[model samples]
Every structure is written in C-alpha cells, then in structure tokens.
Target: MNPLYSPTAERADNRCEYCHAPELVFNDLFKVEHIVPVSHGGSDNTDNLALACRSCNKYKADFQTGTDPDTQTTTRLFHPRQDEWSQHFRYEEEIGEVQGRTPVGRATSDRLQMNRAAQIAARRLWMQLDLFP
Candidate 1:
C-alpha cells in the first residue's frame, strides 16, 4: 500500500475522488493517486494526492487533461483538491450514470471511462443498496 493511502482515503471519505465509487464495496483499498503525475511536475505532497478506484486510476494514468466532448478543446481534468465534485458532476439515479455539468467534468468523465457498461451496472447495484449517491 502507498504510504499516503490512509490519509488520502480519509480525505476522500473512503470514496474515489474522481468517480465517487465507495471503497466499502471493494475487497481492496482504494489507491492513492497523484492528481498530477510526477512526470508532469506534480509532487507527492498530500495536496496532489487523491483516493481512486482501480478503474479510474488505470484510465487516468498520467493524464492531466482531457478533450471536452462539448467544446472539442483540451481541458484540465477535475482536480479533487481544487475542484468541488458537485460543481462539475452529478449522479443521475435513474441511469446510474455520472453526468458532467461542465467542460472539466465532461472531459474527466470521458477520459476516465466513468460511464462504461460495467461501471453503470455496478453503480445501479450500489444505488439499490443505498450505498451510492
């Protein structure tokens, strides 16, 4: 486990900062990920770290920005430390989907594959159990 896991997870309320997936349903602990990759000049400071699920971490990789589908322009990904989740994304209970409310949200959603089929299926189940937003 990463040295920052405990703190990062706690800061994120044991949920994925990007996808907001609760860690309680998973067998493994969430990952402590860099909001900005070291390669891109990000540091290991707590401010740059976020808790993430495997899926979001895998797709986010080293990406700092993504193309917003609406504007067709490059936009910075949602920064958990600097951006409020509700300001950018919304959970649509009916579809078990996270809807992007702004350019940053849209880009981050698409880039992280947050609406993949498996994600939607799991989200629906989580919702039914009252374990999700």
Candidate 2:
C-alpha cells in the first residue's frame, strides 16, 4: 500500500480535498497531491498531503507558487497544512468563480488554475450534487 494514500485519503474522508467528491465513486482517478510540492522542499508528512482529483493533481503538479494572471502579482499556493481553505476562498455561483480575497487563496486559485473551464463545469456538477460548499 502507498503510505501517501492512506492518511491523505482518510484526512479528506475519502473525498477529493479540493472539491470533496466521494473517492469510492472517483476511485483510481484521484491522486494524493502535495500541497507544497516535494520539488519545492515539501515533506512526505500528512500535513503536506491532500487528496485531489486526477485533473486537479495533474494541473497542480510541482507548483508551489504562481502569479495571479489577472493582477500580475506573485503569491504562494494554498498550504492545506498551514492555511485554512474556507479562510482563503469562497464560491460564487452567479459568476462561477472561486473568489479569493486573501493572498493564500488568490495564489492557490491562480496557481492551480482552479477557475478553468473544466473545473467550473465540475463545480457546477458538484453544486448540483450538494457536494460543493
């Protein structure tokens, strides 16, 4: 068994940490992503791990920081271990954007490209299922 899988999955209740989709339904398609990539000196500890859907994981690969393309400001990605998700982001249904008011939130949203077309579509589905917050 992969050590990264057990605790990370459990921490998220077997759901995608980002979107909170049930893993049983998304099995084999979900991945354990490092909130801070190892390449950026992140550790293998549980604090650094997050359960992400395949799409999110692939999109977020090896990125510890990013620039807000809209504002042209650089910021660090959201650290699941150090930062609270709710504190950094809010969902806006009317515009379908994950509004980030904090540096942590804005950076993660930008770094992960969280508001991409596909992610927006996924969020809509998750919203219909009452899986999104």
Which structure among the candidates has the greatest TM-score?
1
TM-score of each: 0.98, 0.82
Which digits, one per residue and each the tens of the lDDT, describe model 2 over residues 1-133? 4567877777787876654545664548478787878888977788778888776677678877777666778788777667777788887886667867787677777766778887788777767777665
Per-residue lDDT of candidate 1, residues 1-133 (tens digit): 8988888888899999999999999999888998999999999999999999999999999999999998899999999999999999999999999989999999999999999999999999999888898
TM-score of 2: 0.82
Predicted model with the maximum lDDT: 1
Clashes of each: 0, 0
Span of 10 residues, lowest total lDDT, candidate 1: 3-12
RMSD in Å for model 2: 2.2
User: Could you tell me which residue pairs clash in candidate 2?
Assistant: none
| 10 residues in a row with least lDDT, candidate 2 | 18-27
lDDT on C-alpha atoms for all candidate structures:
0.94, 0.73
Off by over 4 Å in 1: none
